[model samples]
Target: MVRAGFYLLAIMGFSVSGALGADAVERAVASCWACHGAGAAPKDPTMPIIQGQQAAYLEKQLDAFRSGKREDQIMSSMAESIPARENARAAAMIAALAWPKVAGAATAPAPDSAIACQSCHGADFTGGPGPEGVAPRLAGQFAQYLEARMGAFSRGEIASAATMTAMMKALDADERAKLAKYLSGL
Candidate 1:
């Protein structure tokens, strides 16, 4: 009888632990999908498509957003609710999802604007090389986030010392919009 009781208790314990783990993963994924849907595009033009991004890069960005090191109202707000370890797990999940192709019309920047951006952001806008340190992979980033950053740079919210800020200053509103659209499609 004691042996049977112990067996029952063990089974219950295993079931409870399994449920909790499943719940954690589900919650984490739901939180992320609120912004990055499996197939749905963001309502705002500024939000980037996080699906299919590098897990490490996504984790770093989430950490930055959570820490307030990267300032963006929506991202910061979303990151706030996620714990550090959970954020890493969520980022990994998002990174594993497939990226959707750019839908709708393709908007190209003016020749002059294109030239200006290529000087730093690269002709492809995949960002410059440097795993150790340098430009980030801007390709397929959330459009809203990119636009917000550009706007911040233009308004001097981002310091001029930052290379991004300097480049952003060179772009007018039209150019900024064009760049955001182009980069998001990548």
Candidate 2:
């Protein structure tokens, strides 16, 4: 009887642990999909597609937002409520999703703008590596989303002194729109 009771208790304990783990993962994923899924695409032109981003990069950005180190109203609010460990789990899940191919006609950038952007965003505008912690992938983003974000930085709506912002400031409105359209179709 004693041995049987011990085994039963062990089983129950494991069951409870398993359930909790599953719940944690589910909650984290739901929170992320709430904003990133097709339904949540902000009507504005600036929100980037988060559907199939690199998990490591996503996790880093989430951490930055949570820590109040990154600036964006929506991201800050969302990240603020997530615990660090859970954020990491969410990031992993997002990263696991397959990247979507960009659709529609590709817009071309002016030669000057193309030269300025090619170094970090890649010749194709798919993001490439730079010094550690320097760049994020820009390809496959929605044009409206990209445009809105660049406009925000240009208007001081989003707050990051990062090189991207500097680059944004250099572009005229037409260039920004062209790049956004071009990237979305990549």
Q: Pick the candidate with the highest TM-score.
A: 2
TM-score of every candidate: 0.66, 0.70
Model 1 clash pairs?
Answer: 46-143, 46-144, 46-145, 47-142, 47-143, 47-144, 48-141, 48-142, 48-143
lDDT of each: 0.68, 0.68
lDDT of 1 by residue, 1-186 (tens): 999999999999999987787677667668766656557666555566677666766777788888887787888877866655677777777766776665663554453565666655566665544433334556666666777778988888754236666667777887787777777666
How many residue pairs clash in each candidate at the backbone level?
Answer: 9, 6
Off by over 4 Å in 2: 1-22, 38-47, 71-74, 101-111, 132-134, 155-161
Model 1: CA > 4 A from native: 1-23, 72-74, 109-123, 127-137, 140-145, 159-161
